[model samples]
Target: MGSLSVLLKESWSFVERPDRLAENFYARMFLADPALRDLFPITMDVQRSRLLQAIVHAVQTVDDPEAFGAYLGALGRDHRKFHVLPEQYITVGRCLIAALREACSTQWTIAHEQAWQDAYAAISVKMITAAAADRDNPPYWHAEVVKHERRTPDIAVLTVRPLQPYPYRAGQYVSVECQYHPRLWRVFSIANAPRADGLMQFHVRAVGAGFVSSALVWKAKPGDMLRLGAPIGTMSLDRTSTRDVVCVAGGTGLAPLKSLIEELATFNRTRWVHLFFGVRSRADLYDLGALNQLAGRHSWLSVVPSLSEDPGAPGCEQGTAAEVVARRGPWQEHDFFVSGSPAMVRSTLSTLSVLGIPRQRIRYDTLTSTVTGA
Candidate 1:
């Protein structure tokens, strides 16, 4: 395995364009098995990038069996929606090997082929084992949009009722598949705590090139049906402790943090919670009104809306959420929950570290096509 890792790392250097590598792999895959092509979206751009990213990640983590196995498991669970079968893994592996050989050309050797074969076999077994273990679970839940509100031009708040019981903890996110875009799915955090009626809420921000998000925010309407993947994430509240909590949310990242706060409100503890919601400008602050009302009702909670780029916002603090939290910190005693864009979360985590907060005290879930269960 050490030699296998080294070979892959060295061979990757010969492939100057990862996108071309992904393209070659997919092209060969579709040629070999035409039926597999239908499982993908019309636009292959994102899929290509994801393919290269997955391969790179797998190669990089091959030395860490536990992490690699978990990643493959999550990937397998996510692929259930595509109806991926164990046999398909063989096809993918063959195409992947061929692609690598073509990309590496003279650099490729029989030893490299043998190593990749072993690696792919191991990965496939792990993925198949995970999918088999999850056979009893529903691949996805069909939900009907009962309410859809465009809070801002690019942000939409949706309340959907699952056709069947969907159980998820606060701070978890689900991949949403809109009917308007059949094969495209995007991850969005559940914006509220669970309700007895099986109603789920999602807060979506339509990024410039976000196809699914654009459809959900701009075109989705009441009575439209959508599919929600099985709940997966690791940002839920730690019910074992009643520690003081500090939540730093940027943009739509507020969704999961708000859900966590709502869950805490139901508990009979005196632990204090401070929430700092950050946005680029005052106009981007969508949920401040509701957050303020919630804070007014809950004495244990405090909501601070911060403006990162706009300094003159009437009632908002001036700075990024991390910066604002830094000014107030030395929060060594508080459990921190940070969410939002990847950049925001990363920056906030750095700030927390600088303030002497232990890594174990921070909680966050990074969302992707396949949610990271870590």
Candidate 2:
């Protein structure tokens, strides 16, 4: 791990154009195995970015074996829907090394290649082991949309029923593939807890040029069928803990938080919950009514809607959700769940740290890829 980390750091200077590197990598991969090309989406733009990000993540976590192993396990589980085989990892590793060598040009060394090969072998073993262990589980769930409601111009709440039992914890997210855009998947959090009827709900906010989100929000009908990847995420409620919970959500990030809250309600957990839903304006606050109704029914739950743009809106607290949370003060004792865009989550996390909150008590799911087009 140490040698691989050193090699990665030393080779970082040679990566002048990651886009070109990814392009070369894919070209080499396809050249090696033409059949692999069919597994990828038609558009390689976002896929290139994802590849680069994955490489960076793997390199940075090399020293932390536990984190790296967990990442590989999750990757293996997620790639099951794509039908990735253990043998394919060898091809990918070869292409990756070839891309790095080509990118490095004259600077590429035998030591660097050896380090990468060793690192990739270790990664592949963990991934393959995890995938084999998960063979019994279904790769993906075939679901039919039973209800679709446009909550806002760009946001749609969908109710889908899986043909088979789809078991997932509250606050977990799943990759959704709509028929309109084949091979393209977007991640969305389930909005509700598991019900006896086997109904699953998702809240999707369409951003500019989001293929899956746009198709789901606009083109998808009641009878539309969608493919759901294995559920993945760690932002679930800590049921063993008896501490009060503080949930901070921005825009569509409210979906998972709502699920956690509903799960608590269903379990009759009496812990106090402070939920702060933030939006740019009053018009963007789509689920305020539902949240308010939940809060009204549960004495232990408090819903605070914060408007950063339309502060004067009735019942809306002025400033960002993090700002409002700061004003409330003394949040060190609460277990925190923060969700939103990457920026929002980071900002809230920083605020929590400043308030003397322990890192272990803070929970959030870091998105591996971009869901929104932005």
Candidate 3:
């Protein structure tokens, strides 16, 4: 491991309360230059978490140059939507150092401060280069909803067509900024493979504290407009792999997997697919009808909707999706895809590890998340 990565990891103990550190950093940044505050959302809660998570991810992966550089590049490309400027990077670095010093309390050493400064410079360079190199792409795309259907009280299935052609792969996700939530951007996985019409589908369930999700589920109509950031993520199909697939989805996590299945259906001549779709109750099986139709049309595909909270529901499995998948596995050879809330994804990954599945065989996109699961 690089000496700086080790230093950052060791100093991580000082940030036991990352939320507070994030708050401190933002407060300092805005105070230092009030104009910068305009770049963030009205609600700072999710933004705080994302900021801390981004730092933590960088700290954790600093030793792996390839992965670390790619992550920073994509992150830089994504940050273009914020309209961040070159000079602002210098201001951010200063505020970040001030926040780190406070986070480390009196225990902070001169060596620690120097290491953090060096680290910040490296991070800023990678991000700036990536953003600068992406000169051909627009900062964002504007799309207007053409179809909207309420799937449940809190869930909605919506389709929108970009004003211009929007290109994206099935499993990738793009950050979206709706009119209702103006500056707030939340990522959502594209629910279908690319079509000639340039229409994109999103399945949203209004989460308790998720403002963007609530707006999309309850307020968005056919004529509503939204802004979309560039596509990111690598959870797409592996055409070279002939192994059958097992997909485990909890609630709306089914979005990306369904897209992959659609892509697979177009070209796959072999390889059976088993999908376990889990929800709290049958009422939450908002897309069951659509899933069933897909299964009916594709002989190699099977859809199992599991109810974690409803054991009495007929025609469905009764357990958490991970639990049911474990019971049915021996999935040692199949390529796997798991998606859901952080808790759900972690649980499923642990189950897969216990079942002895190889780490390389699994693919997922946790990047597409709203205040709630997106």
Each model's TM-score?
A: 0.86, 0.91, 0.94
Q: Give the TM-score of candidate 3.
A: 0.94
Error of 3 at 184 (Å): 1.6
Pairs of residues at least 3 apart in sequence or in different chains that clash in candidate 2: none
TM-score of 1: 0.86
What lDDT is reached at residue 60 by model 3? 68
| Two-way TM-score contest, 2 vs 3, winner | 3
Residue range 2-116, candidate 1, lDDT tens digits: 8889987887787877888999999999999999999898988877876776787788778877667866786677678888888999999999999998988998889888888
All-Cα superposition RMSD per candidate: 3.5, 2.5, 1.9
Q: lDDT for every model? A: 0.83, 0.86, 0.86
Relative to the unseen true structure, what is the Cα RMSD of model 1?
3.5
lDDT, candidate 2, 1-374, per-residue tens: 68779998688678999899999999999999999999888987767877886788788778988778877787778789989878999999999999999999999999989988898899899878888898898888899999998999998889999999998889888888989989987788888998899999888888876778888888898999999988877778878898899999999889889999999998655699999999998888989999999999999999999999885898899988998999995887889998888789889889888888998899887672353222
Better of 1 and 2 by TM-score: 2
Best by TM-score: 3
Structural RMSD, model 3: 1.9
Q: Name the regions of candidate 3 deviating beyond 4 angstroms.
A: 368-374
